[model samples]
Target: MKTPSAFYKPLAIGAPEPFREIPVSLERMIHFVPPHIEKMRAKVPDLIEKVDVVLGNLEDAIPADAKSDARNGFIQMARDNDFGSTGLWTRVNCLNSPWFLDDIVEIVGAVGEKLDVVMLPKVEGPWDIHYLDQLLAQLEAKDGLSKPILIHAILETAEGVKNVEQIAAASPRMHGMSLGPADLAASRGMKTTRVGGGHPDYAVLSDADDGGARAAYQQDLWHYTVGKMVDACLSYGIKPFYGPFGDFSDPAACESQFRNAFLMGCLGAWSLHPTQIGIAKKVFSPDAGEVEFARKILEAMPDGTGAVMIDGKMQDDATWKQAKVIFDLAKLVASKDADMAVIYGF
Candidate 1:
């Protein structure tokens, strides 16, 4: 275990000190852009206005031959756009991949000042975070960057799930974690080929009725894992996010999965398609009615102490905390969206 005194110290000489608290931002959707494609890069300016985050994808989806091109393209994108309040992040190739080193070195060297987070894929343990943390510090020091770049891990491997708590506490650089269901499925030898969302096979049957058909209700395949991940992240004061939903044709399922994660304490989710962006914004943002109720709760319990009746339903300290969560999220949404501000009556 790291000594408390040294925990926040810079890992490399001249590196910026790690953040004590994760920066406040409304990250309802992390919109991914395939940096290797020119036409896609052209859409960045417009994309910046829509999404909370713009991530240059340098890993999985990029062709192996275009690794260098992707890196260069991400740099170009970073240089081209102002991004303003929208987070600028990139999903670098995994630690074990050949492109990993160059991805970090080139991206950091060229646009370290503009970069917000480095989304590290296939992280198995704290050791992975530690290595990246130290290396990032070194690069930040070398480039004379003012702020330390944050690390975001993908909880994809079985080993990653096992060591998630340690990984969340690995360093102050941890921005958060994302559940990479497709890769995690392969890691655990799960039978599902789907990227995310529920499976029909993983369902519960209603109690048998005489001469009647048994009803099967599908259960969320990711509930347990997402719960575990959310607990770890919230415990460590870092955010948790839901990853991709592969079936673009099924918008209803995507919205359901995103809503589940949001209710389970995830601050955001990845938007893999244009259609998913609206879904993420709608699902992650607190409902105006809920926010209004939360506001009423706060008004009733000004000190967040003692019990009170809200619409004839009793609320106490525990419920006060829940109300605060919604109110806080609604405030963040209000800041970013003028329409939301009007609707939320902020």
Candidate 2:
């Protein structure tokens, strides 16, 4: 464990000082772009407007031969576009992969200044974060960068899940974590091929009644994992996100899964397809009615203390905090979207 005196110190001489607090940004969806493809790279400028975080993915989907191309493409994408408030991120190859070293080196050397976050995949523990944190500091010092690039871990392996709390508190450069359900399923030897969402066979049947047909209601396979990740992240003051829902054909299911994560305290989710982008934005943003009610709560209890009667229900300090959550989120959504601002009466 790092001592309090050294926790915020730069790992390398002349490296920028570590951040005391993670920068606040409205990240509703991390839209993945396969940077190895030229056509996909062309869409990044427009994508910057639609998505909160535009991630150039150089890992899983890229062919082995195209790893270098993907890395180079991400650098070019970072250089050519000015992302403004929208985050520019990249999902580099995992630590175990041969391409991982070059992916970090070249991208940082070329466009470290514009890059917002580096999404590290399959991190098993705090050791992975420590390694990256030290390396980033060295690289940042060498490149004369002004700010530290944040590390976002992907919880894929079973060991990663087990060591999640430690990982969240691993470094001052830690931005957040995303739940990688497909790889996590494989790591845990779960009997399912789906990337995310609930499994049909993993359902519970209702009580049998006098020879009548029993109903089977499907449960989310990821609830426990998401809850665990959320708690660890919230405890450490980092964000938690839902990973990709691979079934592009089923928009309803994707919305449902995203909504569950949002209700459970996730700030965002991954969007692999263009259609899912809209769904993520809609699900992650606070509802208009809820925002209005939250506004009322704040008005009634200016200091967020004592009990008040609203709609025949008793509200105390607990409910005031709940209302603040919705109101704060609604304000963030309003900042980017003019329509939302009007609808939310912001």
Pairs of residues at least 3 apart in sequence or in different chains that clash in candidate 1: none
Give per-residue lDDT, candidate 2, residue 108: 94
In the range 73-136, model 2's lDDT, one tens digit per residue, is 9999999999999999999999999999999999999999999899999999999999999999
> Model 2, clash count?
0
- Candidate maximizing lDDT: 1
- Tens-digit lDDT track for model 1 on 113-136? 999999999999999999999999
> Which pairs of residues have clashing backbones in candidate 2?
none
Compute the lDDT of residue 310 as modeled in candidate 1. 84
The alpha-carbon lDDT assigned to residue 310 of candidate 2 equals 97
lDDT of 2: 0.95
